[model samples]
Target: MAEREYTAVVYSTTSGRVIYDLDLADDPEWSARINDVGGGRITVPLQGGAGTTRVREWCVPLRYSLGVLLGDHVCQAGPIVPYAPATDKRLLTVGFKGFWELLNRRVLHNKAWNPASAKITDPSADIAITDSLPNIARAIVDHGTTWQNRPGSFLPLDLPAVLPGTGTNVRNYPGYETASVGQRLQEITQVDSGPDVLFQPYLTTSGGFRYIRHRMLIGNPLLVQLGGALKFDYRSSLVALSIAGDGSNQANTAFVKGSGNEAGTLFGYATDTTLIDAGWPALDMVDASHTSASVQSTLDGWARADVALYGTQPEQWQAVVRADAAPPVGSYSPGHYADYSVKNHHWLPNGLYNYRILGVSRSSGTPRGCVDHQLQAVRTG
Candidate 1:
């Protein structure tokens, strides 16, 4: 059997990277030409050496070496698709509309990844009561809890009906359908209303302080089946229906009160309402001036209820506070800071001593303040 012969060639690129030839053959003439023994720009036949019988050829190394080196730094290969600002405008508008459509459909209520029966568990039954369009509308007006069993009767029917620029009509409404994920994504990339609508909620001065509460549920058997310890950055922000300190609206005052400067505080002191001051050291330090034992007790009760509702090991649960803005007085930067933790199920006194104050901003008029809460199980691994 005859062995294959190949020639190797080496060269340098403008970038100073050394490259080697890929196509090589063990041909003496080819090897000599490629080696450039005399270091000449052009290979010349040896003196009187039978005028170059064969030509040596080699592959360039620069292409492959530089290609591999450049690959790592690049995010996407090939020509980039240009994005126009107008396209972005279209996407935002459609994406917003699509998002609301999906929200109205209650698509977030059940996961397509799970079986219908499994996805629609007892919670589904409970949610269904208020899930109906009518009940949801009622919930908006009455500010009352929806009973399980009713369909198409939820709160804020106006929410799903009102279109852009149209006057608020709580009664007469327009029906819009929810879009699928593909449709939503398409709307986000294209400028057409092919799938969704883009709109922003308008918050009027009449609206009061909105509180957003995110409950992280962990250790649920059903949740475990989907995946152990689900982490959801759930958000729910509500506003007090009436002005604080007003006797006529005492029931609503439990959340907030007063129309103007004399607004009475409910659910605790003013500092308690500020997310940054809600956690440990900050809370405890301020307790002397603003917080009462009753306030601390209320926080503890809320924490316990959260654990009971979500934690698998109710006793092992921990709470981490995230504030939305700078601490009124602290050396901490105006950013998220770990301000609290529960050890062995013991609820820390002062409710503020153990947690670190994480500064965050909640200036956005939206009722839901920004905060992320992750529920995790103690890992044995």
Candidate 2:
């Protein structure tokens, strides 16, 4: 049997926080070398090793003004910008212009040497944009066909307005609240002029508001498929209740958890029940007398309805149940069920909050059932 030669490549991120490792098989045609390999470390030549490969190299020049800080002994470190070799299969994080430059240089310029490849199952862009109601309708008509044909794919859209009185409004249409704007734009743009457009809203939820945004991705279940619940006592603001309903309180002063970007806060846990017996807090931060079962049921119902109408399966959706003794407003913070205006403040003062649901066919990848866009007129405080 021919000996199989392998090379390990380990490189750290620019921030020095993440380290990536790659194992490559030696191919004589590539003429690569594994200079050293031991103790979980390997080094390879800049060229030659494995099969034919594409590599991106970057270099940064550094400058410095002499400075030192110390009381007993002085030590110095220079400012250095690091470089890491880019892998072929991984997505490259770069600026828009940089991406365009790379695409033009590697893909477009070297078409003869490297054939421009396309995705076999090219999912539509995660989000879409549009401006007019008729255009949104037309987008639904068109993209809807494609989405229905592909079950796992998603399409979203952004538009200036979809309110009831908007010139190109489609809120009156049923199921519009659930249909994504991308489908709407694809349906309407082909037929008429629409307004300015952008990407669709990606939805996420957490405790407290019952709809706090998280870093998780929406539309695709693979991103955040894990389901669990957690509980915390705002009164102490110190300890975390474990998923096993065990009180594993940490002495760390910074311990708050949820979906938002706040630091030292933990959010959802892995268990369906919490160790703390307190009731779920109200939206206004006032203590609610509701039973945990009741609150859990309400949240479960919302998730179930969402899945029944939009999700492909019940397991694809998950929710976090929080028990707070105080209402959000009572805590002088944003309240749950606050009007859409307080929720999506990025839009103009009068912009409405719209809801849409959509279903795409698993076989043909075309869109099937589409809820017309629902526009809740933006409320002025």
Candidate 3:
């Protein structure tokens, strides 16, 4: 009914080629969507952040590389299962921050002068970080690049990674002695400090990756109150809102038991009270691989994560809004604006509430360069 005017730019960092002028009216077939929609319902999987329980995945297509080329050299391993398209323009092309994430995922060195296939070695492959989950997750994603380019050909993949330690921490290629540049970054964010920590990698307004931990974008919230010119569609578009669990409640406390990895027989344990009410309780937890955190800390970590994730019921609010303004709200690029919280004042059946966009969707398609704030109430008591 309304005339749509917007542009989408797909760039390849490796090739430094930009394909622009992608207006919705130009090609209706080349389109994308925010979150995901099917059967008139829009749903988003768990995000990566504190108090979360799953890891987000980044799988290459059957016959395509990721947005950007990061590994030493890529090749078609062989005929892969399923089916891979001959070409996908989206592959091997991405913005700056995404490329940085890929480069840091793995360690690379050039033996000769700019060799296509460099001498790749990873010192952080076999051992898990044990320091922080984010660091450990980064290590895994770094190595995952190598896996994407393994000798054969595999694409359209969805690799899942579990918690405590990445599933692919101690990785080894089928016939090779070393590991690739990726590790399992698949897991939910543990919510001990605050709510709205993402379980998957989100995109900041600056086109950089947003990890759901700490207070990065919650300083000042943008209010979309009455008459703010906010645009949304219930039936036609794929926007979803719902509530789930909360894991930060006091009743969410539980017992954790562990033992030392040394010669003698050493054991330790703690309850919900000792871990929840008592912020920093002393518990003996020692191991050869990890010692930076105590046994009680680890247990407390899990308890907090559980409570924040599944303890209290969480309210999820998301929408695909539009702005007829000059630069669409979804037209995100670096240095355009800072990552800030967005509150949508709504008229609900019960009453009106201001829900913040706690976690966001990094990948979104725009009909008029518009995007949706995958909003979840930060304080849902």
Residues 4-55, candidate 1, lDDT per residue (tens digit)? 2222222222221223322211111100000001010111122123321211
lDDT: worst 10-residue window of model 1: 30-39
- TM-score per candidate, chains pooled: 0.16, 0.17, 0.37
Model 1 quality (TM-score): 0.16
What lDDT would each prediction earn against the true structure?
0.21, 0.21, 0.28
- How high a TM-score does candidate 2 get? 0.17
What's the ranking of the predictions by TM-score, best on top?
Answer: 3, 2, 1
lDDT at 59, model 3: 19
Q: Is candidate 1 or candidate 3 better by lDDT?
A: 3
Deviation of model 1 at 371, angstroms = 20
Q: Write the per-residue lDDT of candidate 2 for residues 231-257, one digit (tens) a residue.
A: 112212211111122112211111112
Summed over model 2, clashes come to: 72
